[model samples]
Target: MFDTIRRYTARLRTSERAQPQGTVERRAHNLFEAAAVYVAARVEDDQDRIEEAAAWVSPEALSFGVSELACRAVVALARERDESPGAVARDLLGLPAA
Candidate 1:
């Protein structure tokens, strides 16, 4: 779960940087939206692991001050990615593999 959150965060950051300057905020929001797709895509992943990963993608948000909506988006993206948490987060956030 932690890995998945890290991947997602990395991907989102990459995607944000890829965008034009001054669009980081929008990119962040969009990345959050994409998160839903990614999560949805990962359905075979372990639920227990995912639940444990909640620490990373906590709905309460993280230190970055990411909004609850963004967190939900991340989870949604993970699901979209078939529950392949890591891959989905990366896809949504635009982060490369470790």
Candidate 2:
């Protein structure tokens, strides 16, 4: 996961350097950053930060990023617990075993 984020950051830098000086850049925040901040803000009940992060990307993009983050987190937790991802995810949500 960290490797994937690092590669994405590297790609972002390379793309930025390749762009013409006069071109307008998109939002400064990446989707992953936005998703992380947004999720953290929600967990902390920080509406202002949630709004700020949400503004960094389109709603659909944010949703996709959040979903990806959740999947990665579940997989990590599953590995740590020597359990299945589905079981980990269900446990996180307080759901009963299948």
Candidate 3:
């Protein structure tokens, strides 16, 4: 995650330098949006889009967003599987059952 953030930060800086000041009106992509796009991009194996989405928010915010997304996913999977969130998470990661 940190490495992803670092690469995105570099790309963001480069893009910012390339753009002119006060020309384009860009709406800020919140942490949640960034997290969603980042995850979807990863699932689709789109590295560039993942990096671009990661640049939408501060690294700390993006981290929090990603963590929140993971928790939500675990909960949803747990519900679908009729299992506990911890068990679902561990199963997803192939960890030994606790």
Candidate 4:
């Protein structure tokens, strides 16, 4: 089982390395839209789209884009709801108000 898992992991890594260099950059360039799609997927509870968007870019780049999207969303929601950004974020995330 361990060997099988290792082989699968290696294959995935090898495929990632074989991808064209600009592929990640090109995908990252459209991260804003990707991030929007990611957020919409979350809101709509669409797991497949979420995974698809996540697979389009490197994890680090996706993390950055998601953070940027969160900040923008907080700002927009705060303005629309006449609340603080932090409050809006917490509310949207179903967290206790801070």
Which runs of model 3 end up more than 4 angstroms from their true locations?
1-22
User: What TM value does model 1 have?
Assistant: 0.28
Considering TM-score, which of the candidate structures 1 and 3 is the better prediction for this target?
Answer: 3
Q: Pick out the ten consecutive residues of candidate 2 with the lowest summed lDDT.
A: 19-28
Error of 1 at 54 (Å): 27
lDDT-based ranking = 2, 3, 4, 1
What TM-score should be assigned to candidate 3?
A: 0.74
lDDT for 22 (candidate 4): 62
> Which candidate number maximizes TM-score?
3
For each of the candidates, the C-alpha root-mean-square deviation to the true structure, in angstroms, is 20.1, 10.5, 11.9, 10.5
**Model 3 C-alpha lDDT versus the unseen true structure:** 0.94
Per-residue alpha-carbon lDDT of candidate 3 for residues 1-98, written as tens digits (9 for 90 to 100): 99999999999999877977678868899999999999999999999998999899999998999999999999999999999999999999999999
Q: Taking the tens digit of each residue's C-alpha lDDT, what string does model 4 give over 1-98?
A: 99999999999999877987667534343776677788789989999999988777777777888899889878998999999998888888899987
Pairs with steric clashes in candidate 3: none
Candidates 2 and 4, the one with greater lDDT: 2
Q: Model 1 over residues 1-98: C-alpha lDDT tens digits? A: 99999999999989767867665452133434333433533455656544543444435443233455456667787777666667766766789865
TM-score of every model versus the real structure: 0.28, 0.72, 0.74, 0.58
